[model samples]
Target: MDPLLLLFSLSAATCAYLLWFYLLARNLTGPKVWPVFGSLPYLFLNRKRMHDWIASNLCSTGGAATYQTCTIALPFLARRQGFYTVTCHPKNIEHVLRTRFDNYPKGPTWQTAFHDLLGQGIFNSDGDTWLIQRKTAALEFTTRTLRQAMARWVNRTIRTRLWVILDKAARDHTPVDLQDLLLRLTFDNICGLTFGKDPETLSPEMPENPFAIAFDTATEATLQRLIYPGFLWRLKKVLMIGSEDRLKKSLQIVENYMNEAIDARKEKPSDDLLSRFLKKRDMDGNLFPISVLQRIALNFVLAGRDTSSVALSWFFWLVMNHARVEEKILRELKTVLTESRGGEPKRWMEEPLTFDEAEKLTYLKAALAETLRLYPSVPEDFKYVITDDVLPDGTFVPAGSTVTYSIYSVGRMKAIWGEDCMEFRPERWLTAGGDRFEPPKDGYKFVAFNAGPRTCLGKDLAYLQMKSVASAVLLRYRLSTVPGHRVEQKMSLTLFMKNGLRVYLHPRTLA
Candidate 1:
């Protein structure tokens, strides 16, 4: 056969196969699907703008769409794979996340992608392994002693460490990366909580913590595995080349820190997570090995370190941009302070407010919730279907397919949040004809902390951290993004600001 003739023949066959699928699955509507390759090429081409692209398509498709990616099915190197459905529909989200939660575990595919970093921790594990970790962590988190410890830790850190940094930045008029600062602060806080010792990532000189740096690199590399085809990354790993090699090196750095903490706990046990985990044993009277300990430590750092910091960064950005929101928060703070001090605003301004006082700043809490709605810490998540399941909207997802729920896309769905969904309106979270905060009737609709059995155990702790920090900051300062500094989102496992939030802090004026 002539080369041109063969090329033309293959093109014609691809078109024919696509038309055949078009005839068969007419209801299947999403990105442009091709023959054997499915939608891989399109996804590859638009990878840079993936989150935005997915959100736009979901909005247009009435909050649900499927993306299918299969190899061209070549005998030598390629094989058939991938049936992915992404939904922002509240009903579908409820069904997947809550009602039929048992049918969707993180599954083998997710574990494969995150295994290097998360291993068999609570975030990555399923069944009995997850249950044991969950129970152990839950016991620790819900204790009143832990609550008192956290309150003391957070408030003391804010007054002594975080405030001093921002105060210097405000006085010196130096541009600071607020996100970077928060990252360090949270890193220190969570490390203290996890190991009963601070790594001092928040030192005035801001020295780079090797474990923190390596953990970040490892997580970023882990996310790339989800983007590239599994086989290619695995091949690269086997060869000890490229991102996989970097990932391996980074994981070693992270594990060293974990092991050091474990050693510290043994020599001098304290009331921290590591100490508690050391005392725990599973069903067979088998304690979790050091590897399991490492996984749990990594999970705590990932959950506690990044998520709250990133969220606070975004919240500050939103509050700065919307003066009304900021003013409202200030008003709420003033009211709380006045009530607490019995009308001594001057003295209240001078003294650092306690967590109990911060708790009454309802408007500030609502604003934080709204910020999360716009920018969830974990913007998108996927679960592998253990069995064939029907979503509430009647989407038929076959067994072995991965159904993803986009917390980012779902937040922007007008059908779920109404016509003004795109607007940065914290008022949506407030009560009708009143300024009081009101939560959504359907809990699954707002999944910042997730829903059902796997709902984040760290929810209260996160709030304690956020409320304590946010209230303290709002009472003391006014922040604005530095002029001409670019604020963009980074492509990662978590929703981190790409360049970080550069800002100049100004002390608030009060009469």
Candidate 2:
């Protein structure tokens, strides 16, 4: 055949396949599919509120639904072809994430995207490797020495450094973007704990930091991979494309910085987390290699940095929108402080607040939980089927299908959370006895921190960070939203404000 004829024939076949897929999908009574694009076009149409769009589509087409006979752009890659996506239905989630869990793994596609950034760390590994990493991480996280170090580090950073900057802004009657401030604060604190050096991006001056920029670029690239077609990704890699080049540059910057920090820490040992890991050995009596240490550091930086900051940012935004909630939080803070300081206003900067003191603020903890219920940092997560399985609801999912659980949508589901599910009501978290409501045993019903064996390991640490920061700031300064600021959620791995949260703070005076 002539070259022109061959090219025309290939295009004709692709169009025929797409047309057949559309007709076949339309006949099935589930989520609708568009020719050539499948549900991707619908996702792009409502990219801003993709989570809500997916949930609404799922609810409209029965609670547990799938889009059959869809076409992904990349048909050559067997693993990336014709994926089946699922949303949050309790039984469905339980089947995939908990019951018959061994039949589902994070899958090769997911690992490929994150492996470059996280290496072989816990977040990217499975089987014996995952078990080993999780066990080691759990042990280190719960140690008395590490716990004490983390407490001291958080107190100094939040109480001493961050509040000082916020105090100055308040005194000057300046509006601060709490989102940016929280990111810097968490980044610096994570760095100090992990590497024993402070990036100091949280300072009032706010110097331009290269590591922060590179880290942001890496995260953006990872998100892009989620939406882009697999063939395009591979082609870009082969063609020396700019997107791949930029990703490499960003990763190089992070790697170089981590290597230098590891070298410095090795030369002069410190009591930081990295040093502690370096000093300890596995059951084989062999210390973790530098490469493994680097991988661990990368995982810590990526996992610990954005999620907490984003969560706290949303928490403050929710409080600002609901004044009644803010007043209740303030009242709780005052009561906790009074109890802690023996009827006196606790002095800041001069004395560090103990972890026990921070933990005693029951209302503060409840407020944090409510914030998580509204805006889970990780809005959704993906898994792939390893074996053909039937859900408890009798929805048959074939092997190699992709499954997604929408944490954000689950938070807003009326069937799960009652009629005021969409409202920002912290009282929902309060018991009739006026104490904080304990989370349910089967957490799939309210899976902000996720449930089962894969639940977040840093849940306790995150709460501690939020309570400490919120307590210190709310006690000393009153924050109100800037007028005309449209704060809406952004859809990334974590939920952040589309427009950065702008709030004006005024120093509170004791009467």
Question: Candidate 2 regions off by >4 Å?
Answer: 1-31, 62-80, 279-286, 346-352
lDDT (tens digit, per residue) of candidate 1 on 341-369: 86765676555667677667677778888
Q: Output the number of the lDDT-best candidate.
A: 1
Worst 10 residues of 1 by lDDT: 71-80
Please, what is the whole-model Cα lDDT of each candidate in the order they appear? Answer: 0.82, 0.75
| Number of clashes recorded per candidate | 0, 0
- Per-residue CA lDDT of model 2 for 243-344, tens digit only, reads 676778898998898998899899988877788778866557788888878888878887788888998998888776788877877777667667766555
Worst 10 residues of 2 by lDDT: 71-80
- Structure candidate 2, residue pairs in collision: none
